[model samples]
Target chain A: MSDRLAMEDRRSSRLPFPAELGALVAMALAGLLGYLVFPDDLAFLTRLIGIVFLVLSLDLVTGYCGIATLGQSAIFGVAAYAVGNACLAGLVDPVALLGVGMVAGAVMGLASGVLVAKFQGLPQLVLSIAVGQLVAAMANKLSSVTGGSDGLAGISPGPVLGIFNFDLYGRTGYVFSLVVLVIVFVILLRFVRSPFGLLCRAIKDDSLRARMIGARVYPRLILMYGISGAVAGIGGALTAINTGVVGLDSVSFERSAETLVMLVIGGAGTLWGALIGSVVFQIFEHYVSAANPFHWMTILGLMLIVVVLFAPRGLVPLAVSVVDRIAPRLGGKS
Target chain B: MAWTVLGVVLDAISYGMVLFIISIGLSIMMGLMRVVNLAHGAFAMIGGYLASYALKSLGVSYPLAIILAVIGAILISIPFEFLLYRRIYRKSDELTQILLTIGITFVIIGVANYALGPTSKSIPLPAALSGPFDLGFRMIPAHRLFVIACGLCTALLLWLLIDRTEFGVRMRAAVDNGDMAEALGIRTQLIFTAAFALAIGLAAFGGVVGAELLPIEPFYALRYMVTFLVVVSVGGAGSIAGALSASMLLGLADTTGKYLAPEYGEFFFYLAVILAVFLFPNGLLGRKH
Candidate 1:
């Protein structure tokens, strides 16, 4: 009976293919579709891809780890500045700039993680906002390095593998960002399913219970924060490389809030929701602003209220539930 | 140097007063309901815009326009309190509350932007309060004097209302423990609505009166949100006296920092907030849960 139970458990866990691989294929297909459909607006789409990465990173901490923060943009902005300034000072290789961004992001994550782990609820929220604002203020004040309100410009990253140049049409940037996103998503998919990830989830469910089970909750959260920061940094670096500029707006409170909104709209904790939310929001924003720049905010605001009131678990989860109800057999094992 | 310091102090006091008026309602609401109303600034912005419109388009007297704005804000908030916020009050999740309030804030901002244009609108000060007044050592703006007076009067009235009245007692009981307050036969929901309306009225009054200091614009709601949050958090969420003191302290620090180092003012301000939160996690006067 024990042997049969072990066999059943293994069968339940096993799949036709690794889930990460399937997700990667689906993501690559989506990228191809995006590229094929909007060849003219690849630049905007590329920028949106970069933002999607930031939102995904936000999900890792706020979603999986249950650390409520509005300062993920702080790390993103810091890494962008690091890469932009480094490139301006002769480090033009795309991979090298990404490395710089990742390191800077990790450092920021560790510092902020300590503060976040120390407090609960409102204090934690206030601290995160303060830290984000502080970093933005510093960046603005240090005009010599960051270019202040004018923004850091003249970032010219070299080709990826010396084959595709960063072009004005954003063709190369689009493919480059898509590849990086897939890589990061796969790594995160694995990370979130690991034993460590389960421990983090347990902590989120109940930190006291996790501690009672001897989980050392604070250190685990801090590590998760650091990883999330690195992911955000990569996104920021891609933005710098794609746009060839980094502005103070990148780290502003507005960006932080917008990312959080996207995460909530997509469904927190579920990784795919991040991408879905960002895509829908950015597309809606683009068209609406293009048509009526003045009233777009009203529409967006109404959408937010409706989403929160009606579908608190977000669109992705709602979609999954609907799919399950429609075809129980097809939804099996997901 | 002494004169400069005096000027800074006076400016800080008047500025702090406006902050207190706008934030007191927020402090009370948070204390009583445990709801983080991020839309508080948006309500204040509406009041400012309404008052400005009354002065500009309706040709109403400044004092009458202020009163009208306050009434209008309360009337508008009543429906929201009953329909939206009423439901939110039942759900205790902080994130949901934050999201709901933020949605309301965004809608307000959008409406303000569409209705009042993106440019800043100023309420025309009456002739009596338009110019400077002669003092022993220096000239002081009459507008500043009026603001200071209003601030003092508001503080006194609010003190009497919250600390010395039966309703105040019920409200405090609700804040301390809602279940117990209700168990004693107090209709906490009614108290919450009344308190919410009162808070909205105060915010509108402050927004109209302090338009000169803070300005009226579409982004006004988002712009002052952090400042208001800092004030309330540092003051201790529910303590009125704490709000007053925190506002003054922050107001002074802000004024002094801007005067001394224009470039690093925000840096120092946020740094101070970080250190304050780190040292006093529950705010200066907040009780640990």
Candidate 2:
């Protein structure tokens, strides 16, 4: 089992044409297909792309680095609120606002990472929850700034590159989100394949062994957290722009928990898992909730339990295994 | 000023007792079985709902309602233990346990909402407990006194049960070394199931008792999950004394913080938690392995 996991990690991290390039192509096609299929629901699609980023960031620390955090929304929400406040403060430029969000997210991530990297297991989980709750409490107490429970609205961003305006139909926002999602995905693909990423996996597999081999474990963990925060920040910024508001929900415990669920539902520790999980969970939720809001949670909960029990590795890996059984030539490529 | 201070302290102690009663089960389970059972709160919710149902629907007496709630919750937990928990108990990884338990919690919350409606359920106090009782200097609600007395009795009984009985010795042996205890002719599996049932029963009792403070809403499971987790972690898992002190400490901090500075809300409570966890990762009374 350990050997197969290690081999799978190697196959994923290697810049193999079949896995990495193919995944990139698949992501692009999926995003475009989403845009075409649901042109009228551009806002929801844009918001989903934002969540995709958040889950990818979560995959970085929790899946790859062996961190058990339930408070990821702390970083994501901080960056989002930063961009919202910036836009309100007359920074209407979309690209520049995203940079603000990224920096804000990184700062919060690094700060949280410093505290979180020192512990393991249950204590670590509690600490993360504390951090997330602290941010949320502060946001609530300082309601004058955050708009309190009503959320900060009236965020108006100028078009992409000062060219395309954010239309009522959300066309510009959807395209903008898609383009940014693709760019981040490509960068993360390379970032994970880099030596730093390999060192992270090594630390995750066995931190004591990595330390014996002269790796600075805590520093690397902190750095990975900062990178993750930046990715989450982009997602936060996109949400701020697309929704034209940032609310307490952005930094909520529920959001953090939901994002983790999405990550696990698709699979964890793999880039494809993060992307597919967010997409599938979000789309499933959209349809299910619309059909029956009352029983949707029960259905979702049942699905989650089944996923955990039957497909502990998540849907993406389960699909891969099934495909491998049917078509050995195609399956063996990865 | 003295009266106000006394009132606040009494409220704090009562509130703290409720928290302790609810979270001790979670603490013991986490410490002993090494399972992060997020659904523990759901058991508490079930207890609260059952007690409320008994009181309002069946017109049962207060003590009988509490008893029924505890038994019902334990009975309900048996299937979950056999089907879901038995499978994951031996796994080395915490992630699978966390995910699977979280799935259980979601299902419980969803089902509770669907069956019982989303409105909050209140367990009304009996006429005897609802009235005010006179202290030498002032009057206070008898319910607060009742809750505090119940908490003290529970703590004492639990202490004796774990510290004095033959079952306690076996439990400690299993906790110390499961394989060794099994080799010594102890049924570790049976001990685990019994312990789990005990934990669930206590959770139900706490829920019924704490309904005044926490309320029995559909979202109760998720809302108070972090609170219960904080108490257990702060108390040091498996350490009854640790759980007691941590609950009292947090309870004091939260109640006093609210009284002294209502504007601050739960800021101080969460801040204190962060500082506490950072300072002592193993918790106050946790035994270092």
Candidate number with greatest DockQ:
1
Q: What fraction of the true interface does each of the listed models get right, in terms of native contacts kept? A: 0.70, 0.65
How does model 1 score on DockQ?
A: 0.75
Local accuracy of candidate 2 as per-residue lDDT tens digits, A269-297:
88888998999899889998898775887
lDDT of 2 at A105: 93
Off by over 4 Å in 2: A1-20, A329-334
When summed lDDT is taken over every stretch of 10 residues in candidate 1 chain B, the lowest stretch is B89-98
Model 1, B83-134: lDDT tens digits are: 7888776346667777788888888898888877899998999998999988
Q: Candidates' interface RMSDs, in order? A: 1.1, 1.3
Candidate 1: tens digits of C-alpha lDDT, residues A224-268? 899988989998999999999999999999899899999999998
DockQ of every candidate: 0.75, 0.73
lDDT of 2: 0.89
